[model samples]
Target: MNSHKQLFILSCLSLVLVLLSGQFGLQVEAGHHIHHRSKKLFVFGDSYVDTGNTNKSKPGSWKEPYGITSPGKPTGRFSDGRVLTDFIAKYLRLRTPITHRLWDYTVPKHSLKYGMNFAYGGTGVFDTSSSGPNMTAQIDIFNQLVQENVYTLSDITNSIAYVSVAGNDYNYYLATNGSLPGFPSFIASVVNQTTINLIHLQSLGFKRIVVGALQPLGCLPQATAQTSFQSCNSTFNDLVTLHNNLLNRSVTKLNQEINDHNTFTILDIFDGFRTVLNNPSSHNIKERLKPCCFGVSSEYNCGSVDENNVKKYLVCENPESTFFWDELHPTQAGWNAVYNELEKRGLYKILY
Candidate 1:
């Protein structure tokens, strides 16, 4: 067998072992003790969790075909439909957090009963390809809100914070042609900064903070398209593993220092994506690596239209059957499948 197949099998086996060993510390019980004390959610990070924070005119997320699977229109979400934050809100039994742009004028204060979403698509822990606020700046916005008393102490104490860094930092790293030798150090820096961000959120009075693990970069369509969607680039995934490992350690240490096992939690996007991709049939997914919407060639993308309004890309006949919606984001069905796995693994702990 080829190396890709071997790696795939080994990853599957490792997931099984990890699950059985309870290394993730997720409760497997069917029922959970509901925590009704917290009802609001505040979100941070990038496109994966962004509801609609990207600029309306500049970002591709605001263009056609982005939200075709659910709201049936562009809503500044880098997917074909609802992204991670939507599912997380549903899991929490709270209304979706309003985007920061719409929090004041378009929506009323009482409408913020579920809190706010400050994530911006195409952003990272630091500055990235997009011009939106970095993670630090995003937190600064939250901090500003707190100072203005937009949310009172009671509101914060009754809220949960969902922070998704995804892989924008690594994307920026690759885009800048960062050296492989320096990659490990960059990953460590991201974890350290993220740890500080989590601590800041805790200090801001959030009852619980959930940080997402970096997903498998090698499995994304942007990487797989180079191989005609046949196999993932293991070298890229190695970097992802390094990031997740360091992040897990950092979170453990942060929890220890805080003296609260439940103050900070990790949303295992790495294993979650891996399990879904490795077992696509079980998740009712076909075309596992192929994206549902893409440019006909290298110069365009899913919703691209020429000056004459000529379509430049093609969309799949059935987006629901595909795992990816575009070069970098998942289809609605894909997120749902992954969310199901997350729910089964231990999302209940965060919800309840």
Candidate 2:
């Protein structure tokens, strides 16, 4: 071969190698987005991300099918596998935090290393039908630990807080004779209290505080199965809109108050969820509103079992295709999608 032709072929091979390396670099960067942050995650609120924080003796979450996808048995989390907090921690390069309920008996040394998870499943900003501690009480526990020096001011200053209030308070309202006429007043009260909680977390010195906006409750499997899961009930989503607006305004005002630090951010789970639901195929999801697991009837749930160790809830043929893990929560993959959307939109940028 001529010398010029040999050099040309070598140059072409070099170009192809560069392209392949560039593609690999992009994947590494995407993966780092979830695992490179310095701030540790401290989760709060309902089953959307609860990691065994509920009482186990009551058949709450430590039962069959709860952790089937991850641990192959039930853990305290309210999903078939890892929940939202797990993915958030994975993004931050930290371990999935220990639940406060279980930490009392387990390893106490590592409790303060990665921060503590004060979230309780089935709880809300206010007292709900479920008998878990409300958000106010949960914050109190976080505060008590700080006072006891279990978590120092420096630890809190370096840590990030993730608070998720996923409509348990609203459900409580409807369960207790709450009517449409009184919903606005009730919602206002709920958001008002939630704002206080966020502000209080900032006052306690968390570098970044993320409060998740309400998800599309009306589109949950329990609600949609009534309509054959063909479409979402717009009325329920309208209520969600009102809640999100109030939350956005409250977070905005709070951020203004902390202008120097810029310590507060809204996670906007509402819009992130809506984006996936509206464009499921783009996200590799086929069933946006349908749950991966559901009760055989309205009377049962994801963990309910038959006499022969058989699951009562009907699981979807493919969980990765669906956004919801059950009637009320998102699957691990579903939450990964939400977390990515939140990060892509600059929601995780923590200043000061």
Candidate 3:
């Protein structure tokens, strides 16, 4: 027998031995199967958790300097580093889920592996000034894919959905002659509509849905910069608490109404934001009320450009030590702190 032929036979024998041993190759195969069995994450929400699903042609995400920390360039995420979704994915031991718009950009198997992100920035539960799809339309997009068999019924049955309203609807209401005096009614309307959406998602086969409560809007850098970032406007937080209380009760009621053992959950972004904002010093954060990135002048807002097209916004010396990254969102580190709190408080227990 030729030496080459003998080597080939030996290689085949070695492969058989490895398979029978169940030490390396078989273990790898079993591990892969287990990973696939884990819950797939599906995200739907506004700017706070949008991972680049916005229109790229416009100045929306996927532009310069947005993803400077993680992907080293703009990748459509609304943070300098990771966002809430990223932390959630990490907790689940899964990759950052792909955005719905970028679904075609990834491999077909990958698109189905962790589910798709339907969240778009500048959107609300109802219609908004922006032309993008509202919460109902976003769910329609998901349904269209289901009809096309892009995702199987069983795939969705085991999947987890994350929804974030993030106060866009309220902002829209305030912008269009909606006064604070009538805001409670508006809040009730929004939560009622959102409850309908959550039920629809459950009917569509989602195992568990997680929704976020409104954050401390008045404490955001955009609001508190008027006070020189020295203090949070308690009036704003008061409104937020009212909204959150209503939202929590609405979610709890939904969980009770579900016919099956399954339920929709709420992640209290309101308390999560407040916990960080109330004690920024504990997190080594200096300015809890000031955004890390700000316009060169008070008249301007974040993402402002100068005469030479240079960015006029200033990023703080230590982004990790700040809560607000820009006008509305939190920094990656800021979110990490919040996620830690959520984990400590059992908000993410069912998510993974």
Candidate 4:
């Protein structure tokens, strides 16, 4: 991550950080079979999959209580522990890919074991007030790396692509006061651009791509805060349903057009969230929509402070017992439960 005050600023970046691993090389005995293809993984999207791709100087993700669960300090991940990227890589028997912006001094010159992560926090398919690189820009950076031969074409063909397009685009829309009546058309445009991005990846030689469906935005702590964390705003979720439906149709059409049934797929995070929210006890989550960490007042957020450096936001006793870590992201445990739920539903398979 760059040190120059860390760019990638989003509108209400802290309030809505929108999101929305394993060891290297040694094969595990627990795995059944992964010998057929390359184990490389490439992740792209917003804070959901971003593993420190944003600037280190940014306060929201770089602040304390963000990574308190796993690393005990902020490592640029939005959650208190790991995010979706780490778990997905673990399932593939691959190490968590290095962040595209991370340039560790102790790094070896032999090259990255996993492909590379290009997701940035608070970003989306199109540019928002957040002012970070959009999805197309991230892809452009990946293309640049490929042109530099940092990774071979074989790596591109063999790699699995994981994409998370949370709700930042819609957040941007609402933030910018986009009309309610025309909002549906805006969602269609977002899905269209996302499909274009997927097609662009296919052109780059990726065989398998898994994109997350839009999670229920109404259920996020941000909207539920209006109801004192007791219930979700169904109106917001209705729009999310529209987006997911269009995305699914577009992916299916893309697969049909290419005559490859498995080339593109949806990760079905929408259902995963619903599974946990609808039955919190099953996931051991005590609070479904209320975030574990939040501001003492409306003015503060998960990691806020006063002029004397006193903390403003309050953190829960145990983030694991709760579902949301913040207004727009899930706790490490929340993400883990969602991952487990997705597995249970058998929405699709990766690296198979």
Better of 1 and 3 by lDDT: 1
Give the alpha carbon lDDT tens digit for every residue of 1-352 in model 4. 6644354443445324232213333332333443323568898899999988778777678899899999999989999999999988877767898988763343564447677899999999999766569999988998888898877888888788888899898999988999999999999999999999999999998898889999999999999989999999999999999999999899989989989889998898999999999998998989888899999998999888889999999999989999999999999999999989987776335445
RMSD values, in order shown: 11.4, 7.4, 8.7, 13.8
Query: What TM-score would each prediction reach against the true structure?
Result: 0.89, 0.85, 0.85, 0.89
lDDT of 2 by residue, 1-352 (tens): 9999999999998787667556543222343342223355678788886888788875647887677777878888887788888877776667888888766776767665777788878899998877778998999998898898877887788778999989999888988888988898888999999999988888888878888889988888777888888888888889989999998888888877767436777777888888878888876888887788878887788778778977777777777777888888887668778877776877446311
Cα lDDT of model 3 by residue, 20-98, tens digit: 5564323223323222344688888788878878888656356555666667777777777789888888876678888
Model 1, 213-268: lDDT tens per residue? 88899999999988999999999999899988998898889889868888888999
What is candidate 3's CA lDDT for residue 337? 82
Q: In candidate 1, residue 152 scores what lDDT?
A: 88
**Candidate 1 local Cα displacement, residue 13, angstroms:** 44
Worst 10 residues of 1 by lDDT: 21-30
Cα error, residue 136 of model 3, in Å, equals: 0.7
Model 2 misplaced regions, further than 4 Å? 1-38, 106-108, 306-310, 350-352
- Against the hidden true structure, what lDDT does model 2 obtain? 0.79
